[model samples]
Target: MKTDRRSVIIGSALAGVALFAGGTLSAIMDVADARADPSPEALAQAGPLGDVVLGSDQAPVTIVEYASLTCPHCAAFATETFPQLKEKYIDTGKVKFIFREMPFDDLALAAAMVARCVPKDKFIPMVEMLFEQQKQWANQNARQELFNIAKLSGMTQTQFDECLKNEEIAKGLIDTSQRATKEFGVDSTPTFFVNGKILKGNRPLADFEALIKEAAPT
Candidate 1:
């Protein structure tokens, strides 16, 4: 599959690129350059989700993943590739994995919030569920589908409704994603930052294993 062309901004306000079926189009915006922070405070804030340390944090290899729950490719990666990666790298402590939200639509955003609503210990499982059931939810009516899935996670209708309507949480997620896009130049779902080097799209396990070996410390 042909991946979309991603535009990296070296200055202020990263522009959004539209992804079409066959190709992508982007318009570069000229603006005052924003100074890049060698270590962003956002990394610190990610701690609530889990341990996200700096400077070869956890291990020599670090994988920062950006994914959307509604994206088919994101679902594919989670289902087909994440388990092997987890067993080989994450579980062995050879790599530290960070999962970031990259919602492309309101449904995706809502699913992101749902994953966050669960306890930290359940976060990964909830996210996996979201991806595993993507087709079922994606094909159904948005509101009903979301509520039904939330039920699986033990969220009541009222609780799910409130969680979805929480503007503060929603804004926080959007801001985090915006920071990733503006700071790291991420433009698509399932973009992986393997120790700050960008790898975009869902690829086979062999491709990731090769990158992992290259990133891992000797």
Candidate 2:
């Protein structure tokens, strides 16, 4: 029987990624309304690795996004509407944005791991770069392609290798994903929780603007 290299690569890349430590995993599963809309506070709580947030914490509106790195819709939003959203809202201190990983596949998980390994300040830029060049690297050799991307942010080859093999980082991401799924009912990529209101999919800029306006207090 022939062995599938991709499977081996992904398996190796994601080894021990699914191990959720502590009682939080069980607590998340025990939530009475896994599908209920989460409170803004609950949604804003950072995962195991903590959150790399943008804008002021006291902003009038907070936008929490659960996205997969390899999801084209997520890529679209990252490369397209996010800039405008950042300039008009995030940068202006009207909206605080939080990006959470909810990877839907092994490749996305691998990409998320690499994104997490970058410097805190470089995280958003790395995410945007990965989304912009997603077509170029996502379907190619996982190690080489991801390493190429990782190097752009000053990560050495050794660092990249170590990142992929870091059980803690990988597990943190999986824990975050599970929490998003079970606690927040985030079933799709690019699901935005705008002030605790669930808004799914890659909507137009106008739609986001409208939602932000509605969420903003008078």
- Tens digit of lDDT per residue, candidate 1, span 45-135? 4622343222235576777787888889999999999898888777777877878876655556667776777667677777888899898
> What's the TM-score of every candidate structure?
0.76, 0.84
- Model 1 lDDT-worst window of ten: 11-20
lDDT of 1 at 19: 19
Task: List ranges where model 1 is wrong by over 4 Å.
Answer: 1-57
How accurate locally is residue 61 in candidate 1, as Cα lDDT from 0 to 100? 73
By TM-score, the best candidate is 2
Task: Name the Cα RMSD for model 2.
Answer: 7.2
